[model samples]
Target: MRRTSSKYVRHSDEGELLWLRPPTRSGHVFIKVDPTNTSSARMAMGTQQVEVGGRIPVHRHDSQDEILFVYAGQGTVIVGDERAQFKAGTTVFIPQGVWHGVENTSDEPLQVVWVVSPPGLEAMFRDIGTPPGEEAKSLTPEEFAAVAERHGMRVKSH
Candidate 1:
């Protein structure tokens, strides 16, 4: 029932990193893949690098399911009421509307590749994150909520 866009391909090494700082949390550098540049309208994928001791805040996507694959380093992933240890090669599946977050627990950088269905979150990252080579900028809670809401997601309260 839907028309697909032309085929597209991008190498990870050639992607640009954006500094993403969610409200009241440490930021990570992310290489986001633009949905508009791809053929599928229902998927988005990219990688992120979190420095030691950094974490992405608790959040939920209202309309999209997510998969996070740990590419390197150690960390913990909190999903709903469960917590699990993650390391290189760990893969996590987060259903839509589930509360989830990630924390880098090791002394080295944590790298993860993430995919979201019904692609849109990458656009939110572009809207909220700072461009490469620029310092990361912090957002107020209200501002963060607004941005996330625009992309069909919400920042969960701690």
Candidate 2:
């Protein structure tokens, strides 16, 4: 079995975010570590740092389940039909193929360790991701569906 911590492998050597697709998000810094470079063979971990009022819009992993561990600050997680409040030490599990997003609602930045089983699919999101400065504020009902359809990701609204 492998042995390592992504926290150590993906951190910045120069005090900036590292090991993610790119620094294209204004509020988020994501570092994804999978079996190839991490210890968990059946899991992928992404360390995320998001500033206040920042968020990842509702999205889903078509083939993976996810667990979000709140390490600091306050946030809200919209999972399927419900929006749950979270704080440090909170853990939320999101089953596969459901829509979800994490929003930093506190005054301080939010930190979360997202665990995705059997690797994750954010690479595709990265590919289609709008750069930080070009991100959309919010999508209309039809617009949201179109975006997901373009990526072949189904948008589920409970």
Candidate 3:
């Protein structure tokens, strides 16, 4: 029998933090609620910090729908064929298989809280990100592509 508790709480600084480097993505991601830490099996939630001028390249999740709420700073967001201004308080819903991306256009860091249904993106994030205080190793573009592919994500080629 699987025994599980439904309650969970975490402080601002209390989460599994990871750092990502340039060319693919540049930011710090704090995974707060994931299958590894919580009892939920349907979704996962986290906060991502994208530095000024940083961008999360266009990509599509084959099986997960994602929701992103901007918590601070400003940027540009591409959803499918549309480009829109993304700022603090802005929210977006991206359906599965739809291509989307974000670029931080402000001088300050762009902080966004993201939730994905059918919890799987976190796995890809874990594979790509370096833990805080660890020797950061950046993945080659080819390597990144391979990992993304394995995670049911297809990134747009430049």
Candidate 4:
């Protein structure tokens, strides 16, 4: 028998990132729809919205694999060596350690839903004295390096 998690949390993610909490310097408005709890899979699924003319900083998930589905509007997804324009129905796969970023160019918001397998980013926040569903802030160059090293993340200045 499988036991469901005892608690379910819900909150606004970021200031710019809206769905999570304190938005970050990258404007990552994200929402974790299915967290790492006892849900469908041992993964984290989320919806992402990019405000008009806004974009996220380039970064990579060094540990988990990710798949993103563009559901609305138009935008550019920079993945590793290439930047691709995406729209409704475009699905992109991001392997672990591949640099990726998103931008919204349309007058409307760019909407996307993504899945991150083997969820553990929650613990990442714990280690940094931050929390999920909170605005993501920009760290100093040194600070960014430290966190990147700690989380196995690769930050690409773009």
31-126, model 4: which lDDT tens digit per residue? 354444445557866566667776655788878888889888888889889999888999999998888888787889787777777675434443
Residues 1-158 of candidate 2: C-alpha lDDT, one tens digit per residue: 12334434554321223322222233444545665564567876666777777776677777788898999999888999999998999999999888888778899988888877766444434443443445434445455556556654565553
Clashing pairs in 1: none
Give the best candidate by TM-score: 3
lDDT by residue for model 3 over 1-158, one digit each (tens)?
11224348767777778898866888889888888888779999989999988988899999999999999999999999999997899999999999999999999999999999998888898999888778886888888888999999999898
Ranking by TM-score: 3, 1, 4, 2
Task: TM-score each candidate.
Answer: 0.86, 0.64, 0.93, 0.65
Model 1, range 1-158, lDDT digits (tens) per residue?
A: 11223345554544546777755455554544555655567788888887788888789999999999999999899999999998999999999999999999999988889999878878887778787677777889889888889999898876
Candidate 2 residue-wise lDDT at 51: 73
Query: Pairing residues by index, what is the TM-score of model 4?
Result: 0.65
Q: Which stretches of candidate 2 lie over 4 Å from their true place?
A: 1-25, 30-32, 39-41, 125-158
Clashes of 2: 0
Model 4: lDDT equals 0.63
At residue 92, give the lDDT of candidate 2. 92
> Candidates' lDDT values, in order?
0.79, 0.64, 0.88, 0.63
